[model samples]
Target chain A: MGDEKTQVHFGILGCAEIASKVCRAINLSPNSILRAISSRSIEKAKQFAIKNSLSESVKVYGSYEEVLDDPFVDAVYVPLPTSLHLKWAVLAAEKKKHVLLEKPTALDVGELDRILDACESNGVQFMDGSMWYHHPRTARMKEFISDPTLFGQVKTIYSSSSFFPPPQFFETNIRTKADLDAFGALGDAGWYCIGAILWAMNYKMPTTVTALPATIRNSDGVIMSTTVAFHWEQEGTTATFYCSFLSHETMDVLVLGSKGSFHVEDLIIPYEESSASFNFTSGASFADLHIGWNMKEQEVQVHNELPQEALMVKEFSRLVKGIKDSSIRPDTKWREVSRTSQVVLDALKLSVDSGFKRVYI
Target chain B: MGDEKTQVHFGILGCAEIASKVCRAINLSPNSILRAISSRSIEKAKQFAIKNSLSESVKVYGSYEEVLDDPFVDAVYVPLPTSLHLKWAVLAAEKKKHVLLEKPTALDVGELDRILDACESNGVQFMDGSMWYHHPRTARMKEFISDPTLFGQVKTIYSSSSFFPPPQFFETNIRTKADLDAFGALGDAGWYCIGAILWAMNYKMPTTVTALPATIRNSDGVIMSTTVAFHWEQEGTTATFYCSFLSHETMDVLVLGSKGSFHVEDLIIPYEESSASFNFTSGASFADLHIGWNMKEQEVQVHNELPQEALMVKEFSRLVKGIKDSSIRPDTKWREVSRTSQVVLDALKLSVDSGFKRVYI
Candidate 1:
C-alpha cells in the first residue's frame, strides 16, 4: 500500500444517468478508477462501458451481484432506484466493500438503520451520495451563514427547489409507486432541499414537523407532484423550508437575519463558476427605507470547475486514505448525516401517511 | 331602513391598538359610529376615548361586559389576546351583537364551532376579521389567480408572514400561554398566512398538514415557537405556506403556474404604494432560457389610507347594511370564513398533538 498508487477500483451497480456522472468523475480523478459497470441487461452495461471509453481492463456485468463479486472492485456506487438502495448498500457492506449510495440512502429510517448497522458491524465505510455537501460553494455558504458578524442573528431561511420531472419518470417503476415510498416531489427532489437545510443548520433535527403534501397524479394514476414545508428549530433559531417538484424550474435559498438577508439563487447542480450575492440591510427598523442603506450587494466568486460528482468522489477518496489517521473518524459525520436524513424521511412518511400531520422526531 | 341612514353603533371589547384605529374609522365613516370604549379601568377608557377625540355623545365603559350590555352598542370588535378571543367572542355573540373578531377566530376548531353556533343561534353575524381579504388589492390578486386563461395552470402557492411579538407579549396572559391555547407563532401570525393562502385558493381545505412546533415554554418552562406549514390541493394545484412569529418582519407570497409565476412582496401588509410584478416564462421547456415574456409591472395605487382595523370596520359596516338586502347573503360568506379558519387551526393542533403527523382535513 506504500507507493503502488493504492487506486480504489469501483463498480457501479446501475447504468443510471447518475452512474454516468460518477463514472466520468472516477475516470477523471487520480485516486480512483471505473473498474466495472453492471445493469439488468448485459447489452446496456456493455454499451455504457463502450460509450464511456472503458478499456478491456473493465468488465460489464449483466447483474448487480456479478459486479459486486469483482475482487478488483474495492467499493460500489449504488445509483439504483431508491427502493433498491438499502438492499444493495447492505450487500456491499456484507461484502466488506465501501458504499457510496445515492441521495435518500434508503426509503425509510428502518432500512437506513439496518444498512448503517451492517456497514458498522462489517467495518465498511458508508457515505451518502450527497454531492452538494461536498461542493466548495456549499462550504463557503455554510461558513458565511455561521459567521455572526456577517449574518447577524439568523432569523428565517426559505429555500425552494422545484422543477418538472422527466415525462413518465413517475410512472415507469418503483420510483412512482406510493407503497414503495416513492411518491410526489419530496421523495424525488425535496430530499435534497431538506438535506441542504439540515447540513447548513448543523444537523438541527426539527423538534416537530407539520407537513402538508400536495398530491398530484399522472394520467396513469402515478404521483407527479408533492410540495412540503419543513419547520426546523435549533437553539433559538427557527427556519422554514418550501420545496416542490410540480412548478417550473427553481432552485434558491434565502436567509434573513437581524441585519440583512442573503440569497443563493439557482443552487441546483450549481455551476462551478457561479457566484452568490449578499444584500445587507443596515438599520434598526425593518422598513424598506432602512433596508436600503448599506444595502450593498457583495458577490463571492467560486472558481472551482470540478464537476460535483468529482468533488464527491475526491472527498470519499481522501476519507478512505485517512482511515488510519487517529483524528480522522468519518463515522461521526456519517452517523449524523444518516440520522438526519432518516429522521427527515421518517417525518415525511409520517406526514404523508397521517395525511400530512405534524410528526415529532 | 329607508332613506335615513341606519348606523351600526359599535363598542370595542378591548382597548387594543387596533381598536384605536377602528374608533377613528368609525368616526370617519358615515355608515358606522363608535358608540363607546371599554377596558379594565374607566379612567383608561375615558382617556382613550378623549385622546381619540370621540364625541361627548360616546360613552366609556369600565369593563368588557359593560360594553356588551350597553344598549347603544349594536356590534363588538374583539381584539383581545388569542386565548381570550373565543371567550369574549362567545360572550359578544350571546349578547346578540354582530362580531368582527381578529384573525385566528379561536384557539381551537371546537371553540370556533361553538362560537359559530352561538352566533347563528343568536341571529348575529360572526365574521373573522381577516382585513386583508377585503383590501381592494387582495380582490385584484384573487381575480388574477382565479383567471385560468391568464395564469393557465396553477402549480404551487407559497407564502410567509413573520414578525416579532411585542415585549413580554408571550407572558402567562392569553396570547402566549400554551395551556390557554395561545400558540406562539402559529396562532399569532401563521394563521393569517394560512388564511391568506386559503382565501387566495378559494377556501380549499388542505388535504394534509405536517407541522413542526417550537419547544413549548411558560414562565417555568419553554413555550413552543409557533411555526406551521399547510399543504393544500384543489383540482391539481398544490399550495404550501410557512408562517412564524420568530422571523424578522417578512411578508411574501409566490404563486407558480405553467405559464409563469406571480410574486407578491410584503403580502401580509404590503406597502401602500408598491407595485405587484408578475414574471412570465412561456415555452415548452422548463429551462430558464425558454422564458418568453413578462408583463410590465402593475403599480397598485392604494388611495385608501385606513389601517386594517379601519378596513375591517368598513367591511363589517357594508355587510351589516347588506344583511337586509334580499340579494345579499353575508352570513353565508361569514360561515365559510369561520369554517375555513377553524379547519386550519384544528389541523395545526392535530399536527402538534400527533407528533407532527400528517392529518387530513
Candidate 2:
C-alpha cells in the first residue's frame, strides 16, 4: 500500500475459508489493505485472524454489520454462502461500501439483479470473485482469439470444470446442502465454466441454453454433476461445458476458430502462481497425404507479478480509488459481466428443470 | 517380406488421393505387398502405378473386377465413394478376397451389414480403414482408460474432428455430393469422432443420440459441420463431438475419468510420423485454498517404427495370414467395432433428420 490514508480498506464479511485467501490478496495489492474481519461469533473471527496472522492493527468484529458500520471500511469482501449473498451484498451496497461478492453471485439472475441494482443505486463498485479473469494469461488468450487473420471467426468451444472431492464432502460440504447453496456444483464449479465460456464470447448472451440429460443430483436435490450446451444462432457458434463435483480435477477450455484454436488446461487456477501458458495453433492443416499436421500447437507463456487473486483485488481497489479520489463514478463493466454469466446460469438450470429442453434466452 | 510367397497381396480398387497413401502403407508393411492397382480407365491406372513408383511386377487393371478376378490378389482395399462400397466390397468377398474398406464404412449400418454379411458368408476378413486405431499411442491411451484404479470410470468425453478444405472442395469434392457420400461431413469426419468415443467406452452403444441444433449445411443440404451427443444411461456417461469440413483442422479427443483424464489433440492423425504424445492427469486434486493443483498433467509419448497406416495394413494382413496358413476364422472384432460406430453414426443422422430430437438406440 502506498499510503495507509489512501488505500482502499477492506472488511471481510464472514470468516469463510475463501476469505482467508482474499485477505492475503488485499494485503498483496498495492492499493488495498485488510482492515477488519467479521463473523457471527467474535471468538471465531479472532481465531481466523490469528490463524491467518493478520496485522495487530486490524480490527475484529462480532457481526458483519459492525464492519459495515466502520467508517474506515471502504469496501466489503463477501465470501458468504450463496444463500446469504443477496442479503449481505445488498446491505453492504446500501451502506455505501463497495462490494466484491463471491460467485455464484446469487441464487439466480433475479437475486443477482437486485444486488446489482443496490450497488448501482448506492454508487458503489460491484464485482464477482471470479479471480481467473484477472490473470495475465487470460488477456493473452483474448488477444490471440481476437486476431482476425490468425484466429478468424469463432467455430466451437468446449470447457470442463470439475473436481472429485473426498468422500466426506458429499455428506457435509455446504455446497451439498440444498438451502446453504442450492445450485451445488452448478453454482460452485459450473460458475467458472459458464464464466469462462461467456468471457470467450465477449459476454454476449447465448440464444439458447440446453442442459444435457446427464446431470447427477444428490439426495438433497443439489446438482453433483452436469453437462450443458450454448448456441449462438446468429454467429453459428456453439459451446458445451461439463461441470462436476465427482470427477478428477480439471479446468480446461478449448476455443476453436475458423483458422485457429486454443486450449487452456488450468483455466480457473494456474498450475503455478508466477506464470501460466496456453497452447494455440493458427492456420493449421494436414501435411501431404494427411499423415501429419503441418503445424503444432504453440505455447503462449505469460508471467504475472502477483497471483490472479491479488490482481483481482488490485483491479477492484483501483476502481474504488477512482471513485473516492477523483469523484469518478463506479465502473459498471464488471457488474454487466457478472450479470451475463448469472443469466446464462439461470437458463441452464431452467433447462435442467424442464427436462433438458432447449430454453431460449 | 521374410518369405515373399507367404506375404498377403493387396490390390487397390481405385486411384483416389487417399489410395496413394494406402498404397504406400501396403508396401511398407512387411507382411503385405501392393500387388495390383486399378482405375476406371487403363490410362489413369497406369499413371497411378507410375506416380506411386509401384514395383514393375505389380499388375495394372483397367477395371476393379480385373483386380478382384486376379488369383494373386489375396485382399482388396476399396477407396471408392460410399455409393460404390456395397457393390465392390460384396464382389471382393464373394471372390474370396479379404476387404479393407475406407471409413464411413458405408452409407449406413444397413449397407454395412450387407457388405459384412458377404464377408462372413464367404469366409473373408473385413476391416474399415481407420488408421488411428492402429497407432501405438492409441493402445497406450486405452491402457490408461482401462486401468480401474488409475483412470476409474469414465465421466464425460469430448471430441472434435474438422478441416478447412479449399473453396473448390465445396463445389467439386465427392464428399459434398449427396449421392456420392450422402452423409457428408457427418460421414467423412464424424465417423472418426463416433469411433473414438465408442472406443473409449469399450465399443458399447449409447442409449441415446442427440444432434445439437447448430449443424451447418452446404447449399445442397449436405452437412458441412455438426455437433452431437451420446448418452450411456446405464453407465451414467455422456459424450459430445464436433465434426466439420469448414473449420481449421483439429483432431481432439478428451476423456475425463473419475480418477484421471486424458487429452489427445492429434487423435485422428499424429503430428509426426515416428512419435506421438497425449497429456493425462491421474488422481488430481486441488491444493489447499485451491490456489493450485496437487499435480500437473504428465505427457506420455509413444514411438512407432512404422506409420500408423502401415501398422493398420500389417494388422489386417496378419489376420489374412492366420486364415491362409492355419485355417483361422476371420476376426469379428474389427467388424464389430466398425458396426457399432456405424450404428451410432446412423442414430446421429436420425436425430438430425428428426429435427435434432433425441433418438434412442
Candidate 3:
C-alpha cells in the first residue's frame, strides 16, 4: 500500500490458465512482485513463464511445496482446481506465507473454515481471489446504494454470471469433472453471483436460500446451470441469481432500494479495461400521464488506474506487507465475506439436491 | 390499417389512471379515434375528458354499459381493475365491440377463458394492453434472439418490474385489495414480467412454474412482492422474474442464448418517449489471458415514429378494422399468447398459495 520497497513477493501454485491473468496483475501492482511459479510438470511451468514474458529473475519450481518453502516468497496465489485448494492453501498458510486463493474457495464451508483457521493460527493474511471486489467502480456503487436519502433501504438485488464454454471444455475441463471441481458451474460461476449478493448486503448472510426449479446437470452429477433465491427476513431484502456454463457470457448486478436503484451489466469484468460505468437513479417518479420517467438515470463512469485483478493483488499485497513490517493483524472483513459467500453457495447446492426445497441457513 | 377513413372508433370503460396514457395514444394513432369515456359518475368522466383534452366530439357516459351499448363505438378499451375485467370484457364482446383489455386480464385462467369464449362466439378481436410489446425496439430485440448464427438457442430469460408506490396507494389502491386486484403485485407487476418471458420464447408456455420463497403479503392476503421461476423441460429452457410494489422502480429484461445475450434496463417504459436502446452482444468471447472480452457489446438504438401505446392502439385498431371490413375471423394469435401468459401466471399464483411448491402446467 505504501512504496515499492515494502513490496510483497508472490509465488503462484500451478500453471493454470487463470495464472496468466494473475501473473500480469502481480507485475502491474506497484507493491507486489512475482517471485516464482510451480507446477506438477516443470516443463509446463517453464512454458507458461516464457509465454507470459515473465522476468528472468523469477524462478520456476517443480512442486507446489518448493514454492511455499521458499523463504523469499512472502505470499502464495493458489489458482489450482477447487479440489486442490484445501491442501495447498492450508499448507501455504502453515508455511507462514500469506494466501490468496481462487474462489469457490473450497468444496464447502467446512474446508473454507479450516483454511481460515490455518491462516489465523499462523498469523498470515487470507483473501479470496474475487477480483471484482477490488474494482474502483464497486466501491463507488456501494457508496450510492448505502446512501439512505438517495437510495433508501435496500430491498432487493439480482445478480447473474454465465458463459457458454466450448464443447471441449465440457469433455476435458476439470470444472466439469466431479472429482476435480465437484460443484461445477455452481462452484465456478455461481460463486461470483453469491458473492455479489453478500457484498450488496454488506456481508449480512441471508436467512434462507431456495433453489429455483430447472437446475441442469451433466451425466456426472455436476451442475451445468441453475438459479437460486435468497431472503433476509430481518431486513426484508431478497436477492436472486442465475449461473451457468451453457449460456452466453453475461455478468450483471442490479440492486434496488426504496428511493433508487443501481444497475451494471458487466460486474465480473468491465467492458473496457480503462473505465467502467453503471446506471444510478434516485427519486425516479413517473412523468406526467405516466408515459415515461420524470427523472433520468445517471450513467456514472469510473476510471481505473489499474485493472481490477491488479488492484486485487495490490490490496492483498498491502495486507501481507502490514503483517510483515508493522506487526498488524490481518483484515477480518475479507475472511468474513468469503466465508459467508461460501455458506450461501453450499445452501444453494443443498437446496438444488433436495429438489428446490427452501434451505434455512 | 387501410386508411384514416376506415378508422375504428373506441370507447373507454373507466377513467383509470392508465386511461390517460391510452387516450392520448388513441388520438395519436391515425387509424383509431376516441369516441367516448364512461365512469361511475358522469362528472368524473367529463373531468377526465377535460383533463386529457379530449375532442369535443367525444361523448361522456355515466356507466360502463352505456359505452358498451353505444352502437357507434366499434371497440371498447377496458382499463378497469382486474376484478372487474371478466364482467365488463364479456359484456363488451357480447355487444360485438372488439375488446382491448388491460393486463392481468382476468383473476385467473377460468375468467380469461370465459372472456375469450365470449369474444370468440361474437367474432370480436381481443388483445392485451401491454404497451411494451408494440415498441419497435422489442421487435428488433426479438429478431436478434431468434437468430441462430448470432444468438443461437435461447436458453434462459430473467425479467423484473418494481416500483415504490406511495404509502397511501398501498393502503387504498385496488392492487393491494384482495377482492379487487386479488393477485396484488403478482397481478400488477408480475404480468409484464411473465409477458416478457413468454414473448422471448415465442409465446410458448413453460412446463413447470414455481414461486420462489420470500413472498411478502399485506394484511389483506395480497402479495406485496415475489419472484417466480419457470422451466420448460422439452426445450431445456428456463426463466425467472421478480415483481414488487415496495421497492425502487426497475424494469429489466435479460435474455441469454447460446451465442449471445439481449439486455434492456428499462423494458416496460423507456427513459425517453421518442426512442429507446438496448445492449446486444454476439459471439462474445474471452480475451487472450481471459482478463476481458474480445468484443465490446453494441448498444442498438431504435427510433419510434409513434409512442409504444400509440403503436399498440394502431395495431388493435387494424385488427378491428380487418374484422369489420373483410368479414375475417378474429386473429387467434393474440388470444393464444394472452392465454398462455395468463396460464403461467395462474400456475405461479397457485404455487405461491400452495407454499411455493412446483405447479406443473
Candidate 4:
C-alpha cells in the first residue's frame, strides 16, 4: 500500500476450498483486502464468505466474469481449476487487473506463456500463488546454501510432497478429472516439489527429467503418485522429487552440497503458523576428510509476523502498488521463476507418458 | 560369555580399516572374542592390533588362509573388498567358521548364493555386516511402520546414503578401483540404501529396477553417485534410493504409509554412538482432510546398551553358538534377506549398464 492512490483490492474468482486460505491471507496482508467472492451461484459464494467470516462489505458475485468486471477490484485471485487458468488469467490482465493465479499455473507452459504475455502487454503484475517461497525460513536457507565457503557447490536436491486425500475425494475432485486439471497429481502435489527443486538450484533449468516407474493412476487416468528425477548435466547437479495423492502427508526438501547439507521437513506448509525451522550442517574446518559428524548442526528457527500466504499476498500487493503509484512496470521475476517450474513439470508429465523415458527440458 | 564352553571365538581376515570397527564390536560383544588377526604381513597385523588397542592374548597370522585354518577360530569376519568376498567367504565357511561378511555381500546374487550355499553345507551362520539392522532404534522403528492401524500399508520409501569422500580416495581407495569394488558408489554406499528399502518392504523383491539418469562416474567408470528406483508391482509399493561418494554425507530413510509416515535421518550410522531417533506421525482421526497440520509428530528416541555394530556381533555370535551348542541349523532367514538385497542391487547395476533401462527381477 502506498499513499491512498494504490491499495490492491482482491476479488477471489472461485469459492474453492483453497480460496478460503487465501481470503484469510488477503485479510492478514496489510496492503491487500478481500473485496469480493464469486462462484457459479451467488448463494454458494455468500455461504462460503459467511463460513469463512468475511467482512460485511465484501461483494458476492454469481459469475467469475462479474468479479473481473468490477472496477473496484484492483486484482483477481484466480483459484479456478488448471483448465480455466489461461482464459481467466489472461482476461484479468486484459482488464488491467493484477493476477494472483493458483498453482499448476496452467495446463502447460504454452498456456502459462500466453497468460504471461497478456500480463506483460497489459502492464499488470502476474504471480502464481507459490506461498511457501515467501516464508522467512526459505530466505535463511538460501543464505546458507549460497555460501561457497561454508556449503561449497550444490550437488543434489531431493524434494517430496505427498498427501493421501480422503477416499471420497478421489472420485469427486476436479484435480483427478482429465479435462479439468489433466496433469493430476503431477500438477497438484508435484508442482510444489518441482518448485522447491528449482528454487534450491538457484532457478537453473535441468537438462533432462526422467519419471520413476510405478506411477499409480485412478480409473480416470489421473496420476495418483509418481517420482521424477532431474539432471543438471553441466553443473553435475541432480535432483529427484516424489509427489502423490495416495500417500501420507510429508513435505521435505534436502539440499546436499560439497561442504554442507540442509534439510527441512515442512517446506510446503509449516507445522505451525508462528514459525518454521531448517537444519544445516557445514563440515568442520579441521575435518578435511569431508565428514559431516565433526560439525555441529545449526538448527535455525525463523519467526514470522504473518503466515507465509499472507507474506505472498503482501509481496504481490507491493508489486501491484508499485505499478500503480510510480511509472514502474510489473516485475517479471515472478513469472520467470513460475515458467521455469512449469517447464520442468511439463517434461515430467511427458516422461511419464513416454514410459518413464528421459525427456530433455 | 557361555559360562565356559560356549564363547564364540573369532578370526579377522584382511586387516581392512573397517575391521577396526568390527574388531571393537567383537571386543564389546560378551559372547564373542577376537581370537586372531590376519594380514599379508604378520607385522602389519600386529601393528593393527596395537593401533586398535587389541588384547595381547589375540594371535596375529601372516595370511588369511592361516587364520581360516586355525581350529580354535570358530568364526571369521571378512572385511575384504567385494571382489574377494565370494572366494574368502566360501573358504571360511568350508573351514566351519561362521562368516560375518562386510557388505555388497557379493557382486551378484549368484556369488551370494554360492557363499550362502557354502555356509549351509558347512553348518555355519551367515549374516552381512549391515550393522544398523541390529540397532535397537531399528526394532523400534519397525514396530511403528508395521502397525496396520497406525501406519496402514507402506506406500512408498525413499532412502539415500551419500558421503563426500576425500578427493584422494578416488585415486587410492579400493572402492574406486574397477577390479576391486567395480560397482563403486553403487556397491559401497548404494548397498545400504537398497538394503533399507528391501527391509522396509519386509524383504519383498522388487518386480523391476530402473536406474535414474545422471549417474556420475569417475575416470575408471565407477559410479561416483547415482539413484535407482525399485517397484514392487504386486505389493503396490515403490522405492527410490540415491547413493554417492561426491556429496555431503546424508543418511535418510523415509517411509510413507497410507495412514502415517516415518523418517529416520541417520539410518546407516547414528550421529552419536549411544542413541538415535526417528520421527513418526499417525494423522488425527477426525481430520481425514489430508492436511497434515493436525498431526503432532512423535519423536521416538532409542538408547543402545552397546553400539549397533556390537549388537550385530552379538546377534551373529548368538546364532553361531546355537549351531555349536544345540541341534540348530544355520538361520536361513539371514541368507534370504541378504540374497534378496543382492538380487535388487544386481538388477540396479544391470539397469545402469543397460543405458538406464528397466531390468526385471
All DockQ scores: 0.14, 0.80, 0.66, 0.43
Give the poorly placed runs of model 3, Cα more than 4 Å off: A1-5, B1-5
TM-score, candidate number 1 = 0.68
Model 2 TM-score?
Answer: 0.99
- lDDT of each residue in B1-361, candidate 3, tens digit only: 3354688999999999999999999999999988899999999999999998888999999999999889899999999999999999999999999999998999999999999999999999999998999999999998999899999998888888999988799878889998998799988889899999999999887988887667889999999999788888887788888899988888889898989998897889888999999998988878877777887789999999999999999999888888999998898988997999899888988998998888898
Better of 1 and 2 by TM-score: 2
How big an interface RMSD has model 1? 6.4
Q: What is the TM-score of each candidate against the true structure?
A: 0.68, 0.99, 0.97, 0.96
True contacts kept of 3: 0.64
Worst 10 residues of 3 chain A by lDDT: A1-10
Q: Write the per-residue lDDT of candidate 2 for residues B121-220, one digit (tens) a residue.
A: 9999999999999999999999999999999999999999999999999999889998898789999999999999999999989988888888888778
Best by TM-score: 2
Chain A TM-score across all models, in listed order: 0.88, 0.99, 0.98, 0.96
- Quality class of the docking in candidate 3, CAPRI style: medium
lDDT of 2 by residue, A170-226 (tens): 987889998989889998999999998899899988888888888898999899999
Q: If both were scored by TM-score, which would come out higher, candidate 1 or candidate 4? A: 4
TM-score of chain A of 4: 0.96
Query: Interface RMSD in Å per candidate, to 1 decimal?
Result: 6.4, 0.9, 1.6, 3.5
Each candidate's lDDT (Cα)? 0.65, 0.93, 0.90, 0.86
> What shift in Å separates residue B296 of candidate 4 from its native position after superposition?
3.3
Model 3, A1-361: lDDT tens digits are: 3354678999999988899999999989999999999999899889998999999989999889899999999999999999999999999999999999998899999999999999999999999999999999999999999899999988888888999988899999988988988788888889999998998898888988987667889999999998778888887788888899998898889888888998888888898898999999998877788778887679999999999999999999888888999999999989998999889888988998898788999
